[model samples]
Target: MSDKKLALVTGASRGIGFAIAERLIADGYRVVGTATSEAGAESLQTKLREHGDEHSALVLNISDSEQTEAALKALLSEYGTPFVVVNNAGITRDNLFLRLNEDDWNAVVNTNLTGVFRVCKALAKAMLKQKAGSIVNISSIIGTTGNGGQANYAAAKAGLEGFSRSLAQEIASRNITVNCVAPGFIQTDMTDVLPETQKEAILASIPGKRFGHVDDIAGAVAFLASEDARYITGQTIHVNGGMNMG
Candidate 1:
């Protein structure tokens, strides 16, 4: 309705998702950001409103199949079809493989891997019909490097990258691209509480000598969503400040 193309970002209540939403809005896209709760959706709506009315927020629980289907149906009906879809919603349940329970593994896998499958499946048909779109899935360096206490999380992220590559190949004929942005050691509330010694150890591993900012990830997503990245598909853009360079 705003003449701007539509973009959808998941997990947009805070951190990298929020930054991606904001960056897309600034890029002149009508963005609909999603959160798992009404309060978070409302807060996101409020913050996004400061930018313009063309952007809004929704409550979407991607981990639930029925809910995800219903929410995506409503979104398609109301917003038409999104020109960009960013699968940035993910959850981590960290535990040593020996200590991890089935529930924890399932929870992480369901939310991180299967949940993305749901979102992409729900939108893929419409995108193919439109014959124009971009999909950017947020991944992590741990998916490649494999952290000690995050076996479940690592598997999910690794599966996600594989999924992106396969989907990109399937949709490239239709002029739609699917890709990933894998970040490493991003500076967020989760990392803020780490002890100074731990933080220093992390910094020492990065050639950049700093944790990445949300905007750094946002910039990568923005590029992948733009016309500039039209030829780039089925690739993972690493935004980890050279932390996991092969």
Candidate 2:
């Protein structure tokens, strides 16, 4: 086995997930990033090569139960139990509740909420045996402060946070921590396409008056995954630029 610690990051093809995987690599972990498709996995592997060969990418569609189980089994067999697992894989099905079809709601909830449960369930036993691990689920500010056209997305994210807390309580005695990192409007492809007027409105809402960078969220995840945060669990670290402060 490699001397470096192991970590798994889901939805790591691009955007926030990619940034988190890169950050973990820089922090001296042997990171295994998951993408939804073979093509996405290949692209992720290529992009992450600049960091070094210490990290790898694999195809793992968390939304599919069978695929998730098989992929995770192969992953654990090859790389051993990960000391850190970041549930960053999520999909957004944005639509008003009235117009949102069942398919869209199910897609978002299954992938974003239930998918996380699947990943955590698969790893929990192994981590329990190891008696040392950290689980960081990526949440969104919308989960806490509901959005206009994202009922499904919001509900899923909110459910994620609750699940994290419960899991944290269950595993804390074994030295495993479960926490969340809730990000506000981060500047990604999803937000980049917004109209200038909409962007301005969003910027005005943020106390920082600027969009958050991927690195901002990455930094928080890195912290939660580190020894420094070993005592911290069942809590959320918000990187929302004061957008939804309590």
Candidate 3:
């Protein structure tokens, strides 16, 4: 369309991913966002249209290698390679570490860590060929400061940072930058599902005295994806309302 930079946001039907897509579109990128289901794709399309925007949506289940490969092929063939890739699809199965089942741990690692790897691996060649790209991986504060009930989630997310760091080093010569956004207690559908007591307890630990808005994370992400952050690489920008700082 505009020849402006393109951004692809995974799991963008709602929450932080939705916010990032909206921000990028407003800034004039032709964005393509992904969701897991046909219904989710349709809903995301409707929402984007209501914004009177030009962004598109696709059904992508990143944990499924076949589905991810097919989706990437279709995206590149139709929409062209994205100048920016946001790996944001993730799920959490929280329980005490001793009570965590193998299935639960595997699912978290597969979706959060393996999924990001799949996207980056599939797209690296195109990005290197283009001689420029931005990769913003969505991580969590728990990744750096592990939480008691989120061992699996924390491990996957933490591994994502290490992955990004290594990948950044490898791609820096090609002018591609890789970074992560570690968000804490962002007000999203996921957080809304928490019990009131749990929510209140979370708020109590935040020195900023409130939960972060999705837009807060979105703004930070857009900035990192922009030309302004061209000189930055292998870093994680935290948006946690002072919940965890390291």
Candidate 4:
């Protein structure tokens, strides 16, 4: 309703996705977020009341093409084409390559890589019609640097950055920009699931002497999504507290 832009954040039920959605709403972007379940969608709505209904929630499995398409349609019909969209829906099935199954590989790729493709394909036309938009894909440091037991996840995320680069070029003439933010270890349920010894090892690796906070990653993403980053595209902004210079 205000002069602010509208944004859609996928996988916003919690963790980094929730942080991004919350910050976007606070920054005055009318936010619409998607979750994989009904309960998650309802929770998002409740969390969004502070931001008002100009921003809302949708429930859809981003990994499922049909469901993803339907969710985008519903959002567009209800709230119009968003000015910003963040593709943050992703899953991880960490295991050694020797033990990794086809299902594990497919699941990660479908959700992390192809799911983003689906959302963008669904939204890009609307964005083109508007003649402008900004998209930020949430990637992981493991994508670029690689990890021992995350071949599928790393591949999917790395593929995301590549996809974003190509799409950015195709849409730039239309005033659309695409970029990615790869976060290091950040406080989240997923990270909390790691064993204490592993957590300590991770912390020791970060030059900042600790794992990054959710807000740290959120701030980086917000910058990329803002007008201030209008001239930037097809770039990866790493928020890992100097873990990897690349």
The order of the candidates by lDDT, greatest first, is 1, 2, 3, 4
- Comparing 2 and 4 by TM-score, which wins? 2
Q: Give Cα distance to truth, residue 220, candidate 1, Å.
A: 0.4
User: How do the residues 1-246 of candidate 1 rate in per-residue lDDT, one tens digit apiece?
Assistant: 788999999999999999999999989999999999999999999999999988899999999999999999999999989999999999988888899999999999999999999999999899999999999999999889999999999999999999999999999999999999999999999999999999999999999999999999999999999999999999999999999887
1-246, model 4: which lDDT tens digit per residue? Answer: 446688899989888988999999889888888899999899888888777866788897988999889888988887888998998888888899999999999999999999999999999889999998899999999999999989999999999999999999999999999999999989887788999999989888899988888889889889988889999999999999899995
**Compared with the true structure, what per-residue lDDT tens digits does model 3 show for residues 1-246?**
657777899999988999999998887788888999999999998888775556789999988988898899888888888899999999989999999999999999999999999999888888899998899999999999999999999999999999999999999999999999999988887788999999989999999989999999999889988899999999999999998877
Show the lowest summed lDDT stretch of 10 residues, model 1: 237-246
Off by over 4 Å in 1: none
**Steric collisions counted per model:** 0, 0, 0, 0
- Per-residue lDDT of candidate 2, residues 1-246 (tens digit): 678999999999899999999999989999899999999999998888778786788999989999999999999999999999999999888888899999999999999999999999988899999999999999999999999999999999999999999999999999999999999999999899999999999999999999999999999999999999999999989998999888
Q: Which rank order by TM-score, best down to worst?
A: 1, 2, 4, 3
Global CA lDDT computed for model 1: 0.95
In Å, residue 54's CA in model 4 sits off its true spot by 2.2
For model 3 the local lDDT of residue 213 reads 98
lDDT score, residue 188, model 2? 97
Best-matching candidate per lDDT: 1
